[model samples]
Target chain A: MLAVDMAGETVRAMNGSMVAYDGEMTFKRQGMTGGEGLRGALRRRVAGESMTLMEVTGQGTVYFASEATEVTLVELAGDTLLVESDSLLALDGRLQTGVQFIGLRGMGTGQGLATTKVEGQGTVAILSDGPAIALEVAPGTPLCVDPHAYVAHRGQLQQDVVTDVNWRTVLGQGSGESVQFRYQGHGLVYVQPAERGGILEI
Target chain B: MTSTTFNAATLPANDNVNPYAFSVDLNGQWFTQKGKMIAYYGQIRFQALSAGPLDMLVAESFHSPLYAHDWIVAEGQGKLLLADRGFDINSYDLDKGNLTIRAANLLAFEPGLELKQSIIPGFLTLIGTGRFVAASNGPVHFVEPPIRVDPQALLGWADCPSPCHHYDHGYVRGVLGAARMMFGVGGTSGEEHQFDFTGEGTVLIQSSEHVTSSDAMLRELEGQIGMLGVPGLRQLHGTIAQRLAAEQQH
Candidate 1:
């Protein structure tokens, strides 16, 4: 049994079957550019059926999630964490301020991101469900990746919404029309190794 | 009870109307017969409150905070959203003109209407007749049935002669007798439980202003014997009680 020290914070299941958290809990993560072989390159896509739980605490925030059949616990800041859910979230839980969860469907895309602020002296833990790779970007740097090829991250990351689509992307090659969840805060980000979507759903 | 009466035949008329209004207040029962929202404050028998103009009964409830929905009545058919889930639904006995539902789900109620312990279909949420209460608030106050109410929220007591603590009747006949009394409320009897609401019920609600986790809840019962005195302070006492229990052991 994992004890929640906080009242509300966002959390989602990760590869390690743990929950990762932040304030304005986000759905997208930033993947690294070049360098590592397919192992690091392929870590950009792959997330499975996930639900995020967050609670608020006087000490800041605590989060919990069921990982590859295991339960994970973590602490987070006011700026990280997001909520995204569809039919998966039943009424057994509650939702609080400063947290969010995003549910992604292969045939769907919408602006489900929320606004938030995270900062200063806070302890946070991110659980990688499978093997996850971390990528860091310095201030004033712009990093890009396939929309479906990344996990969670901190920093002033903005995903611009666009409707116009190119022929190749629209023809099932995956929508070439993409938006970016840009990062900017001075915090560590956790990204799972996968490309083109979560680990092959079996 | 004012002698104000309304005539159904002399009411307004309309066509192609399904939703409607049913009002029961101090004067009597009035039906707009063609609106989505309807409110009442007293007792009255309704002809029909359904798709033929569904029933929407909202009242101040002799209990609870804001407004509330009480019992709904139709001539031969009716449906009432008595509790929170589908499990608490009760089908109307058209021939008997009665709609029976459980009691516990009746958190708060309106005047003239009662919160009763009726037989609800068995489901995950129901056990034994799932307790409920029916009440009203217009000209007269009523405890529709013998309901098992929490001793807390008993504000001030009136009639009813018996000791306070276990089972006791209402103010129907007696005015004072030691019934199993719930503190702060009048009527039959209940336990020395704290009063929590602002309105009426099987137990009267105590008078309290705002409260957070840190504030004293049972603030008004400072001099009253058997009361926790203050809600927060009572909790503190519980902690102290545990400490005392431990100290004696050593």
Candidate 2:
């Protein structure tokens, strides 16, 4: 559960994710574009990374939850966070949500070829099957993550899909660890303990 | 509550970073089950057990030919994180001792431990000194035996020499019991059968009774089918057909 204390400040959350509020509050569903204007709506439609958000303005504490999954709050200071639309829960109104192309890294998880990018300043809450572990990447140390477990990433990182195909894979005796996402640069990557069963068995 | 962000330097070395994930400070190599690795930092290389470079290590520590394909060797420097389908993961340390665990529950173990196939068809045994991680449906409880545990709840046993099938004799004695066994007409308590364990050792049981997928059991049956002659195979096919028909009706 996440509690947001507001003194008449506005926040945008996943539609219908508000569980309860202690103060005077009003929720208005942000239409097709998710408050990103007509261009964002069109982009979302084409990219297939649709996010339905609602504006919540209140004066007291409000609670938000989804599927009883654990929530992790990430505070951003102008850096961009690239996350799957399904994993995004809520974020402050100041953050701008946009779509970015992520290539085949998203193919394994059946999440399409793009991801939602959140920029600007404010706190964003993302959901995960379990608690999310944040791993740091630097020039000296690159990180390899299973695509199914990757939730979000921030900073100046370059990610590419690494496919390890050998003769065994041709014999139908492929090692399940055949595909991975290699992240290099300086940033933090968030991964959940559980893998989202998808096209990639691993 | 706010949780601390763990970076490469903050991640624990060979310890659980949380209840559901474990971080291995991999300076050398660790044998990890397939699909259990969530993320990792540093220069780690994952090679299948059959990979040429790992042939020598596989010969020394891994002995289960049936499951060799299901494991990989993770070698190099940095911290490697592993988890199994969001199940509760716990690490166990062995000091020249042996512990057998459900095949699906064993996630990753240090190369110092020798892994062998247990006598029990769906279980794996680890011997020698080292740390290994296993996942349970719920928190695991350790109980001393001379005890009978529901088959679904028995996770594994450590140093217990005897673990055999035990049936409630009273429920299977008379003519009625014989009829019930022959035909699926009567309803018997599902707990009528259990795994009985004895000797000096600890028995591990998950709080929840959920069992892992039955792929291991299916594989074991497939291996044994080779011993059956044509007539035996025909009978087995007939039995399976009957069972399938009954299931469809339900």
Candidate 3:
């Protein structure tokens, strides 16, 4: 659970994520066009990345929670965060949210063909099955992460699909770690300790 | 929890990042269960146990034919992170000892240990001096035997004789009890059955009675069906169909 103090400032949160509030607060459903406007809504609709958010404006502290999952707060400063729409919980109202096409790499990960891009300045709250671990991706040390456990990533990093598939995979005797996201450059990758079953799980 | 960032240099060598995840500093090889690896840094290569190059290593240490397809050998130098369905993961060291664990709970083990199928169904025994990782639904409790534990809560036992099924006395005490058991009419307290353990050694039990789903267990059951012959197989098929029909009704 996350408690956000509001002093007349607004925060956009996941729909129905508000568990309780101490003072007066009003939640207005984000309009037909998401917070990013019609362009983001159209891209999200096209890419199958849909997020339902509500604008919370009040004078007191509001608590947000979703299904008792653990929450991770990422403070972004003019950098972009690529996260799954389903994992997004809440974010500062000042941030801009959009959808970015992540190409074929997303297909093998079971995260779809696009991911929600959160940019601008403020904290973005993401949910994970367990506490998310942050791994630093530096110049020479590339990180390979199971797509199913991947939560979110930020910084100037290049994400590529690394495949170790061979005839063994075809014979149903392949290593389950055949598909992975190889992240390089400079950035931090957040991965949940638990894996969300993906296409490769079979 | 505050997010602490770990780089390849800082990731622990053969240790846990938290209660739910473990990190292995892989220099040579680690036998890992399929789909347990969450992430890793540095250079690493995952090969199927059936792969040709790993034939010698697997033949020496891995003896469980029933679980061959469910395992892979991660070979190379890197920091490997492993987790299982968000369960609490812990690494246990075997100093030239034997330990049997639920097949579904065993995540990965060092190549120094020899893994074989235990006599008990849905359990595997590791013999040798090495390290292995296992995940439990909750914190694992170690208790001495002369104890009866909920079957679902029993993780595994070390250096002890296998346990036997123990049913509550009330389950068969009277005519009313017998009738209720036969018809399945009355609601059960769900605490009548337990695993009775005795003799020396330690018994491991998870705090929760929730067992992870195991397709391997189903396969083990299927493998044992071969000895039943035609008549017994037919009877078992009929019984299973009836059970499936009953389940669908609910």
Each candidate's interface RMSD: 31.0, 1.5, 0.8
Model 3 Cα lDDT, one tens digit per residue, A1-202: 9999999998999999999999989999999897777887888899998889999998999999999999999999999999998999999999999999999888866778999999999999999999999999999999999989999999999999899888888888889888899999999999999988676653
Candidate No. with top DockQ: 3
DockQ of each: 0.01, 0.70, 0.85
lDDT of 3 at B124: 95
The sequence of per-residue lDDT tens digits that candidate 1 reaches over residues B125-188 is 1112112222211111224223333432221222222113443334323534333232334542
TM-score of candidate 1 against the unseen true structure? 0.23
The parts of candidate 3 lying over 4 Å away from their true place are: A199-202, B241-250
RMSD of each: 23.6, 1.8, 1.7
lDDT by residue for model 1 (A1-202), tens? 1333443433322222224334433332212311223443343122322233322223333344443311222234444433222211111112122223233322232323322122333443333322323334444433332233333454454433222233422443221223333344343333322223323210
Error of 3 at A196 (Å): 1.0
Q: Local error of candidate 3 at B149, Å?
A: 0.9
Q: Model 2, stretches more than 4 Å misplaced?
A: B185-187
Docking model 3 quality class: high
- Would you list the clashing residue pairs of candidate 2? none
> What overall lDDT goes with each candidate model?
0.27, 0.89, 0.92
**Which clashing pairs does model 3 show?**
none
| Better-scoring candidate (DockQ), 1 or 3 | 3
